[model samples]
Target: MVNEAQEYLADPVLGERVAAELRALLRDPNRLPVLVLATLWPVHWQRLTARRDPDAHAQARALLEEGTRIRVPDSFTAADAHVLAAEGSDPRLRRARECAVNGEITQYLAGVPVLLQRYEDATADARALLDAAIDARRLGWGVDLPTEFLADAASGYLTRAEWDEYGEQWPAPALADTDEHRGGFPGPLTRVRPRRRLRQTAPVDRPACRLADAVEQHGRRSRADTFPAETFWTASLAHADAPTLITLAESARIRGLYRTQMQLLATGALSNADAAAELVNPLTIPALGALGEVSRWAASIVPLTDPGPLARFLRTLHSANQKEAIEVVLARGPGRRAELSNRFGVADLVRRLYDWNHYGRFPESVRSAASAELAALLTRHPDGPTDTGDPKSLARFVNMLEAPAAACATATALRPRSQPDPDPSDAEADEAPETAMVLASRLKRLAEAGNDRALIDLLAEKPARRVAVSDPSGVAHLLRELTRIADTYDVDEVRQLSKRESVTLIADRRPLERVDLTDPTGVALLLGWLNRYHGHWTSWPDRFLHRLEHRRDPLYLSLRDQPYRNAEHLVWQWERAMLGRFATRAAEVALTDARGVADLLNTLSPRTFNYCPQPVAQAALARLLERNPAHHVPLVGASIDGSAAEVLIRALRDAGDPEAASHLQQRAFAAGAYPYLRRSEYRDYGLLPDGTWSPVWTWADMVPSY
Candidate 1:
């Protein structure tokens, strides 16, 4: 089709017709030549332009020359030359000529009339584009123009009414309710409001009087009605409520009004009935079944008054109950009849008893009641040598001795005398070992029962002294038994004793040489002790070094079996200590042994080496150089040698006739070697036989041996 067009254009008649058609289309203000040709022949615009006849080009040039003759603004029409710049059948050339000579030139020749006409045309075009955009937006088809085009067009054509209508019609989901149609309601419409459905009535009946009044009347008279008292008390205890009940209880207790105080105690409306009970219960005769409750009640009350009496009372009750309970078990005598005894002997019961007696005062009823029972037992048993002559019993007797009043008040009592020094000579005069053993056993039971003082007293006895000192297993067993005692219980003395014994045992037992070096726990304990006492003694270094060197064989064996294990850890510790004590020696060791050097170097982190001591740094560097000679020249050239090189120099000098020192110094001064170092200084400080500095041969004077 393109070839047919070209052939036709070559003929005069056909070419003339085609040229006339192109001219007609180009001259029309609304018709474009490219669009006209495209409609007639659906070929590429470039191909269509290339098919333009020679006659068409001549006609276009004539039209442009004619259009230019009409005077026009330079801005209104494209220059005449721009139309004919491209040759051949180019569509751009035709379009350019048409735009210049036709629409633009005609508008420019018409002057201000043309300007107003162009403005009106532009405004009409803008409005049409806006309407098209809005239609697309309404259909949910996105706008196609760039942001600038849309913004410019919208600015020129959008009106206030149009904007309002657009917003109302296209309200976002969140603002849909505020749209014009929704806002046209007669009254305000809230999306959320209280429900209007039938409300369910609560089933609970309302009281006749206010809760406070009802609580006050019914809460005070009966103990069983504690519910109302508890509820009312909680409500009344609020910071905003009146303190009538609290003030009444305080006033009643102060005036010695026992019945009034008891009434307040029964009321339970007060926040502190427990406090009131503690004060009042001791003065009342306790009911049989209520002894335990009454004693606890007294203890709770004691802190509110002089704690002395309450403390004494609580201790008395503890001693009495303990004795009665023990007696009850002993009377049953190691049989099924004593089954109830096991339940009462639990550690929890012992803790409770300890808290009650050791923490607070003795209850008067328990003290008074136990006094008679204790007196009867003492009268039957007496203070003479015990039947078993057991040491455990002697230890118990010693604990009993500390609280003389509790024991002396009994029917059997030790004779009182002037203070006398404890007789060491008369071992026989001391409590018999059998009795002491029995007492120690009982005291241990009491300690297990959480009675720290009883345990201490048992430990102080002659028989217990042997067990405590000579028996490591026995002491460990005892510590395990009392392990629950808090650190605050003055157990530091025992801990110190255990530490001393542990050290002795550790030192006496040789470390297992063939065992795992990965398990440094045994060695770690000794090292930890050394760290703990780092500054206490001067001899510790020798002792530590001796232990480390002696244990080296075992450590080595362990490391051999498990190279990837904590083998590095032990070597690190050894290196740290060596560096601390004999840094030079450590360096020598590292230089001699590759594995030891590697382990030591691994311990030295980059951060530590950043500010390491000059000698230490030099030692490390020398060792590294010896192990890896290739790294030596680059390391020196990098200027990281710093003080380490000087340290290495000094060390080599100290050793007579050092070859390594001479070799390094010679290399440093050689041509093209270590350019980073100062050559003049290197020559000035020459190597000596003793590796010391002596004014020696300069770099210029040295012969090239390499």
Candidate 2:
């Protein structure tokens, strides 16, 4: 085919026909060749003019000369029967029209973009005419015009509303150049109306709290139905029935009105279906459902072919809603495959939860929720998970769960609830092992020489084990006893993720640290053991001494006077003192922020280094706070050394707090309020070998400068 084309074109007989056609076109004297020349990029013309071959360059240069020499048609013609009247309007739009009338394609292309500078600023008629030419060009009818004319015209086309109004301006300008068409321009090119959503105004602009107040006040005198429709429709809502509903949706997103919007949707007060139907076109779906209106929002999701928007929208919904939406996809999505490896983001969620792969990409809260759900999916059905490919192999646990609920109650029995504190006299002895550790020791002891009372207690805790399993003492208790010594793992519970499928590694509301068994803490955690000195303390010491211990530089000079060597005892003392001194205030403060208790705990943290340092103290304080004595002393922010304390105290003072004065007084007392509020003070005293005083400074003056 290639050889044939070359041979046929090369024939002199075919060549002459082409040359005749060229001559006819060149002699025609229409501005089309000039128009086509105008559209050619200057760089392209330069390439041709600068060609190496003389004949080719001459031909290109001639075309260039022809374009330049071609007189731009200054006169005008009537593509439209109407008068070419953009008379007193924008000079640019009028100029565009003059070129259009005269069929001056090159001239029109050159001037259109420059002349019609501002579409919005342009007069209505000017805008309409410009839009008409652009549409007609796009529709492949503006033939007499240059192809580039549409490009310039579109730079300043009619406003959206003008597009529908001007429909088809005139018979398409039939151009002389048959090959020229703006085929690259987008089509189905008729313009639609400006979206009512953009133009409409919401009823109110206040935040939720203020709106709630207003709603409360409004409800006091008149019902929501009786509340003025006029109030909601201050704008000329006439012929704006759909827009009015849209306005309401916008208002509802503003804050307090989310429920109001849902109410409207539920009751059909806004005629949601009608409003949606009215704007069913891709151009008019208003933004919605950001305030967790998901299930209802499902019906109105934009039918955009792109799933990205929908996926992102689903993420912003409430967790329950998010799970529901995922379930929706699982239950009704393509083929309704209820298989475990569905595209429900379950695997991703599971991966995120366990820190399996995503690292910390999802927040801990999200991970916690994902974990709960994955656990539920594993445990929900009696048959257990349907797929082996599940990220969590739930099927293996079917045998474990088949046992009665009593079998699962071992964890609760092992860690008995609400035991009394040990006697203070027992501090030095500290010989009593942890109950779990004791259990471990007892099991070993029993295998050697059984004790009946201990066995009875064990049987009481594990009644299902009275009959015994493989182990004579009961396999369940033996297995449960491993948590005391070997660091075996277990699910916290048969967790119900929701009321769908649903972070505590050990137990609900219990702290968890994954056991390595190699490290001391891990070893102690697993064996329910502690080396008595793990945490023992005596009193709250000065901050300076506390800071030394905090830095891991424990000086005997600091610890020598302390009666207790155990850091744990000191933490125990600090808590008793803290609660005793500030119970009332702490309770009040916890209402506002539980971290207030943590803040107080952190204040003593430097001194409590070995027992309850920051991370450890925070956990302990959290557990203590969770127990909620209903009375905790509000922290004396002024007494704590930080700007946060000052800020808190200042806030209370500004709020006219009575205790603010007392707290400030405490701050003063802490800052050495008395001339000599004496405590035993020790200064470093250098001594010689014979115990005689040494010179303060053989090096420098007493109050020495560096």
Candidate 3:
């Protein structure tokens, strides 16, 4: 009953009311500061002004003054008369007076009430999300939170690896009940946080010294005066899983607990070995000053002595951990020159540095050293660029664009192949593969500065299309000023510099502005850019429509040979719109291509068959009927079991149009006028006028490879 009453009194709002009543007694000059302190939290009194407060020493002395050092209660029970005198028989009556006195000046009224109680009231999922957001903000991890936080809150739970990796939402699965929906209990291997491990309550302020301790502990009005997070991190580290330890290291990084983070970094047994990399992001992780002596040697900075405790600590690590630990040393330019080579081959270390380029947290000197070594490796001609990675990695070497023209060319040459968090408490790890974020930022910055030369300079640097798509948040800001961004380069320059990825991104995903298309350059660029995927005949149509749908001009109709034939997959309903537009094109122009003929067959108004006004479709079907199976590829994008032209031919023949049939037979043996659906070298051949054999191709075979 007493515990329940104490919890009720702990209510922050009620605590404020009780504080006012205790402070009101201070107006009686007879009251000793010591007695007054016993009845109220020192926080309220510290903020209060006494008459002698103007002088610094006087203020300090007055704040801690005692009346002749009289003995005070070892602990003040609220039942004591000193407190009960100010307390009221009715809680409501006391609240009404305190509320009337404080009025607008109260802390509760200063801002939206964000009491910790509200955080507790949130659902597990919501609380996790809130905690993750708060953790990310405090840790300085970028806003792009991990996927765990993004999953359906009701179903997914953050894993130890994920939590340690990204610091998503907390509850750590082990801490929460086994929801039937989320499988059985997490099991014995799961490390559950102790319920009361991190926080300790001060024994409810007892003697005069206890109140003084509260004042000392509370420090200034600012929360920064307390190193409470230190305790939070320390408790977390003692019990955290390998993944969670990384998060603790990150917290230590935030708290300037460099020594603590360094100790953690020396441990290689972490569930995720990458924790060491995260701990010392060069600038954030300064050179471990004076635990050991560091001196400069050429471009290499070396520790003259061992890195103090870290040297002994390295012996305890696994090989991988030892490698990472030494790399951290080498990266900080502290260890011997060949240390990286000894631990990881020189070539391998270069690749690790390349990976770190994506991190963007490495010190400039470290990054420069890595880049120089990589360049030197390339210069030696011992191994080709392909020795490191594929063209895709080369393409997306986040800093590849930041590289000078020569270095970017090297990365471009190497491009082709592209390439788990354990901490639940850490909730959010750094943004995974922030390459998009990094590239987008560069584009945004370059675009803002109107550096057309630099923007165009990126024409040489390329990544895969999906990889090149900028982050939505970054792109949103980019698009808001796209017109200005577009103006940075000439319209012709855009076409000249545009990669297949960029053309598709603007044409489909982030639509180009009307002004960009006014010259018809961007439209043509979109069309040409689409030529890269002709190999996937089934998908090419979808790609074309997807990429061209945003084009203001209906130039698709004007093209003599449209590559895409599938309409069922029309994402933007462009098939219907394009068919409607096709009604206006000349019959000869529309009939030659299989897509044109197939469009006509499916789009015919079901209500009427006689004198169908789709003459282009009608003529095209007649022409196709003339050709035998040998004359066309067996199947095109629009073709059913029979070829597109063959299917249409049957429909026309069934319609019993003699004029069309006569026209079909008259030219039946003649060479096909349109592209074949399924042409092959074996059947798709013709006799030359000179009587020698030559390959014959439908019009599609003739469209130049862009």
Q: What's each prediction's TM-score?
A: 0.14, 0.17, 0.18
lDDT of 3 by residue, 301-324 (tens): 222122222222222222223333
Q: Write the per-residue lDDT of candidate 2 for residues 28-103, one digit (tens) a residue.
A: 4453342232333222334335543112234334334443322333444554313546334656546566545445
Which residues of candidate 1, in runs, are more than 4 Å off? 1-410, 413-530, 535-547, 551-706
User: Which TM-score value belongs to model 3?
Assistant: 0.18
Tens-digit lDDT string for candidate 1 (580-640)? 3322333333132222333333333233333334466556546544554222322221122
lDDT of 2: 0.31
Worst 10-residue lDDT window, candidate 3? 206-215
Scored against the true structure, residue 342 in model 1 reaches a CA lDDT of 21
- lDDT per prediction? 0.32, 0.31, 0.34
Error of 2 at 547 (Å): 62
Count of residue pairs whose backbone atoms collide, per candidate: 36, 26, 27
Model number with the top lDDT? 3
Our model 1 lands, by Cα RMSD against the true structure, at 48.4
